[model samples]
Target: MIESISKASAVSGTKATESFSSLFEAPAATLEGTGATALNGETFMSALGNVAMQAANNLKRGEEVSFDGLTGKANTREVVDAVMQAEQSLQTAIAFRDKIVNAYLEITKMQI
Candidate 1:
């Protein structure tokens, strides 16, 4: 899956600078509550929800493709590609969730 991702990214040359760490980064918090300033917790949860939804959608698509392939209505290549993409998306979403959970755990450990 990693090899396929690297190959795809190399061909596109559009996602070169984005590392895995950046995917889980919490966006900058505003100094004061004002226009365009979303609560940091809300923003993080929104991001997490978006990524999870995407991963779920990918998996659903992959499952559909697999079923189609079984029925001889879709190409095997489509199934393989969809499943691979779903796998990568799921891994990414899981990693993001783990990072958020770990950060929360660390914060809870801090003494007042």
Candidate 2:
């Protein structure tokens, strides 16, 4: 029973991540009239913004799942999955941010 539950969660977690990532497939679409070059610079910021939004959404979903689990409206397995996914998303965002900061520091350290 435990193994089956874990397997189910693993599958669902993958699906959820895929759906979230799919949201960023076309960041430039909303700016229909702008030249593609303008969008090129915006794309990095847009992707970062999207990732931050996803992390927030995942954390919110985790809270909802936890509440549901507490009230007996959701399965424990689901709560575990939601919380785990949220934690992973948060960690990834933080790491990405740290990498960006490090890059900025390195650039600033250059004599140029």
Candidate 3:
């Protein structure tokens, strides 16, 4: 799922130079209590959910492949591919979740 993000600036006449760190940092808080924003929580969760679902579906396909007989409705390559895809998707989702949780914990430790 693509999240629509819009950016605007009021630079006078020069180009702007920004680093990648700017993308990850949360906005500074102010007096109005409106600056504590989540860092792509919805998008990240959506992506993680999608990958997990795909992994589960792939595993089901692998099981189906086995049940369908190796010569009738499925082949060895198909089963192998399905299993590999499921494994890779599961690994990726785990890694992403770990990274996000680690980032949140690190931010919580900041001297703010």
What are the Cα lDDT values of the candidates?
0.67, 0.71, 0.55
Rank by lDDT, highest first.
Answer: 2, 1, 3
Return the lDDT, model 1, position 110.
100
| Model 2: CA > 4 A from native | 1-42
1-112: candidate 1 lDDT, tens digit per residue: 2344234334323453244434544455442333455454464434655666667778778878888999999998998999899889878877986987898799899999
Q: Which residue pairs show backbone clashes in model 2?
A: none
Candidate 3: residue pairs that collide: none
90: Cα error in model 2, Å: 0.8
User: Which model is ahead, 1 or 2, in terms of TM-score?
Assistant: 2
Lowest lDDT 10-residue stretch of candidate 1: 4-13
**40-83 per-residue lDDT for model 3 (tens digits):** 44433344445656656665666677667566787777777776
Q: Supply the TM-score for candidate 1.
A: 0.61
Q: Give the higher-TM-score candidate: 1 or 3.
A: 1
Candidate 3 stretches with Cα past 4 Å from truth are 1-45, 69-72
Give the best candidate by TM-score.
Answer: 2
lDDT of 2 at 1: 20
Alpha-carbon TM-score of each model against the true structure? 0.61, 0.62, 0.48
RMSD versus native structure for model 1: 13.5
TM-score, structure 3 vs. true: 0.48
